[model samples]
Target chain A: MELRQFCSQSRVVIVAGKGGVGKTTVTAALALAATRAGLSALICEVEGKSGLAAAFGSDALEYDELHLDDRLTARTLAPDDAMVDYLESHGMKRFSHRLAKSGALDVVATAVPGMKDILVLGKIKSLEQLPAADLIVVDAPAAGHAITFLLAAQGLLDAIRVGPIRKQATEVVEMLTDATRCQVMLVTLPEETPVNELIETAFAVEDRAGVALGPVVVNGCMAPLRDQPDSITSLMAAGFSLTTSTQAIEAVAFRSSRHAMQEIQIARLAEQLPLPQIHLPQLLTAAIGRAELNKLADAMAHQIELLQ
Target chain B: MTAFANLATTREIIVCCGTGGVGKTTTAAVLAIEAARRGRRAVVVTIDPAKRLADALGLDALSDEPKLIDQQTWNIFDRDPARSGLAQGTLSALMLDTKSTFDKLVHEHAPDEPAADRILDNRFYRNISGALGGTQEYMAMEKLHELHTSGEFDLIVIDTPPSRHALDFLDAPERLMRLLDNRMFRLLMMPTKTYLKLAGAALQALLRTVSRVVGREVVDDAIAFFQAFEGMEQGFRDRAAKVQELIDDPATAFVLVTTPRRDAVDEATYFAQRLESNGLQVAGLIVNRIHPEFGSESPESLRALAHGNAAILNLADFREIAIRERETLETLTARIPSDAVGYVPLLDEDVHNIATLATVATHLF
Candidate 1:
């Protein structure tokens, strides 16, 4: 499953992983890829992570939707704002005033169990169902809770057997269950804990929700240094050989171990999951921006082609 | 002494707080082992659901009280079988079950049986206790207070839940209590119930609608739960306030834990800033999984020598790992407050069992 092929085919694509595993970066890269493909794409965020905004090189964007380019748009859904929008859409504005005045809104809103999730899902559903956009990519919350958020609509449907709530829940569930139109990708690092969590997340998504699992992107893999140990050791033993500097010896040794560790982790992950695997090299640069995202997009495009 | 070494002797409480999957539990265990080795009677408690401490300590199970480990138990606590031979000074551990702790709080505060039963039996309460983000943090404090007041342990270490919003634990009680104390809910319900008493048929229709939406059984259970907790919300509020005071006390110390990764550091920084803003005493920071800085050599020389030779390459890989590890260390040191950074190197094997923990402890201290 190449990134473009998957993006072109699916309406709802969720990027999820342990926090700090570059889910936002991957989401931005995919959105950029979609835009390059001439498809109008929207990158939606539920947790208000500014990573997306930072990736897009814009600080002025707020919770509302803003166009990143002619074909790409990005937006963040604040739970409170989403709640207000949801209430207003349901014609509860009159009740809102009364509720706010009497402190009923405080109680209802504070304990508004599942309201954040409901609104987030509602927003994603709205964006996906919109005729203007070809794809909607959600930079979802961290792994553990993202599952809960995705499953909330279905859970609510089960709890609420009748009325408008059930109808809304049904619509959300249908969108999530339509595998041809929806796909969930697990983003992970080549480390023990995150990899383990990613595997668990995959099982949970498949078992609970009937969503299709796409390629797993193992980010930040380090390739081992190619060199001979005896010569390096001999050089180190000889202490200042003209052929090698101490810093060079250190750098090679350091890179080699990281590369080996990463390889082991990647191998472990590949064996555990049946899904196609994409490996992203560890970049030396600290600040990743649109240019870096474009580079990643190119790589994803090639991977997508191979998958096809 | 290094900044972290000073922490070992000076700090009373070292709370290992971080985002999830950053090895907070293992780090906490290692710290406790180190403190104990330094002759402090250390006790580590974990509030995470993962229960990693047992695996780290090589223990089959951890009770509500501290369990001792290590072959040199003679150095601190007694290893003898006699009743009085058990040494008072040594390392120990306990795991906190947040839900059970919450249940205990309810039992302690509820005014009557009905109120207690309502809170305990309420579906909402059950869900909140089990799933709420901050409850574990609150419960952790409650347990810490219990251990602190017990006077048995010399040093107490706490491992918080791996929350992206690390400060949520500190803020949970207030958020939960505020929701419970929403004055508008009471006023709205008061008039609505009276109006329903007059318009019985209309009230019945509303009830039917609610029952259908939330499930008749769940609604009934909730009503029963609320009815039991009648007039007891204030008690819970007061207890929560007391707990908050204890958490804010100066004697308690918070230790932020993180890996070298950008995301982990961001979270640690956020936690540090929040804790500092709240006037909480943040003792120090622990950067785990640091790569060691090997002796300097250029990448070209090392690569040229490492390539085409398996042994050379493996050694080169070790050195490269060490170099990256150094970069991570430097990054962490620069980002974290200068006075409060401790470094722990990445080990080859999992730190599972007391012996491995002791090895880790040596490095941390």
Candidate 2:
């Protein structure tokens, strides 16, 4: 219902956005929030993406989940590894090893569309089913693919009417569509492209999977530097020279215009996205690491409270 | 050091790539449009689903075929078009549709109609063609190859899929080769040969036993797919090799597009290494959406220069961003060693139309 409540209650929380829109950062922030809220969280990603690893500031992740802190574990999930685990869970451990060795797992991951996604989802679902983890936050693929991923099971179920694969698809679909079980959050930047794409993706997710679309997390928002009670133009007219300090005037002008543009886009995002939204202020640090993620988590908590 | 830095007259195949969300699509579009304004026929191939490319080009849609832009919009851009060494060029763009391109490839490359129908009609192809790993990247190259070989344009620009690693597009051909040449792959195809019937029987039996473990339908789907693709495998292999050659050609160049963010810079450096390691050419680097570099002096000096002029100088916010971004970009540029590095100031608004793209192209060219 509420932002913090949804973060705590949902079995699986997926964060999605366009490429380079800071989806991984938002996912890590959510994971941190979930951990802080006392919900043991497992942050999942499609393996080989170092974004999550960079966000968490740890390279220890592999098939086994690395415990980052109390109640928080992060792991990168690969389709191939998920296939191996799927086979092993299906009681074909030796077969999986042989398949992996022969590189058939690559074939499976490469050739099959929904198969790869299903395997990854199956793994996430398994982790979600675990009693040890209260919530699972999946850092999903960028917009187009993320929607395809969430609807992969439904696509298969629609295509294959009667089969074991269909049955598996049904279960994944159930988990995804159930509001109490899942919430898909669309992370965005207060920019035109990402916000527009997020709107399209939100509608597509609802149309295709009927999943509960969580609040929009607007990352990289530039808030006002300080409340300037008066305009610089007035001061310039009040006696400030324009030509000598052209660089400063230009930089200040650029910053003010950019901040003004962000506000317009933010308003556009609010009017366009049907779901609730939380704005995460832009980070000024040169690098993004755990400290930035924790700071974002704290900011996210404040926004959650504000929205409530 | 940048071979194709002067993209205006380079007259080469420019492939824009970098980590996702760093503006490859827009860069590719801008370059193509710049080429067009310079009087060459240029086409931009983009796989990004955002449709920003379409908007930037002032078009409602960009399909596989190169559609002419609205004359009114072109006229507006054409007014001061030659202001920046621009030629009287023409531009058109193609947004990639991998599924449609696959269908076209099937139509042209497949042995016969029924053979094409067999692969096309297969349920697996219906569901998986678009989603198949590397298909988008592979097909983008395939389409690029088709366009490059054609005598259509003076310049061709390709925007790669916004993958985490831009190398995925470059590696797609080799990876596709591996998938086709894998040991299990040959074993799976054994059943198609008449002379290998006995071995096929053995392998097929083992497959059935394996099928029971995973699922009959999935394994059967794989079997059916391989059977349908048997005739076309060689064609795919040949084209993949051709694309590999095309990428490594001297007339083709790769442009790394990135923002000034630390992650973008890190990935750009890593991407540069991957390109160099693979023996591909790095034409230049275009750092997109960077905060405007304030002044030639330090931020403190720049702020101090504003004495007596303002009650409040908001230069700190922008000055801080500008400095951090410059440092981050310097870290990447130092590693790249490409003198052709160009920085496009972060626009007040997103580059939405051809006019805005024209302004960006000024910085790039």
Predicted model with the maximum DockQ? 2
**Candidate 2 at B278: error in angstroms?**
1.4
Provide DockQ values for all models, in the order shown.
0.18, 0.47
User: What is the C-alpha lDDT profile of model 2 across A1-308, one tens digit per residue?
Assistant: 34457677678988888888888888888888877777778888774565677566677568888888788988878878888788788766757777788777765554445877887887777777774478888889877789888888877665555644556677888889888888898988887878788889999898877988878998988776454425545545645445424555565566567778888888998897767788898886667887888999898877887874
Per-residue lDDT of model 2, residues B1-365, tens digit only? 12333664575699888877787887887777766766778888888877878877767788887776644554344434445444477777788888888888887878999989988877657645676677778888888888888878888888876776446777888876776677665666665565256455545554654556445666667667777788788888888889999888888878899999988888888888889999875778998887766554555654565553342355644666778887887788788987477888777678777677767766765
lDDT of 1 by residue, B187-296 (tens): 32344567466646743554454444344655555445445555777877776777677677665667787776555676777787788777775677777766555555
Q: Cα lDDT of model 1 overall?
A: 0.67
Candidate 2: pairs in clash: A240-B309, B36-B89, B37-B87, B38-B87, B39-B87, B39-B88, B39-B89, B40-B89
lDDT score for residue A275 of model 1? 85
Q: Proportion of native contacts found in each model?
A: 0.16, 0.45
Candidate with the greatest lDDT versus the true structure: 2
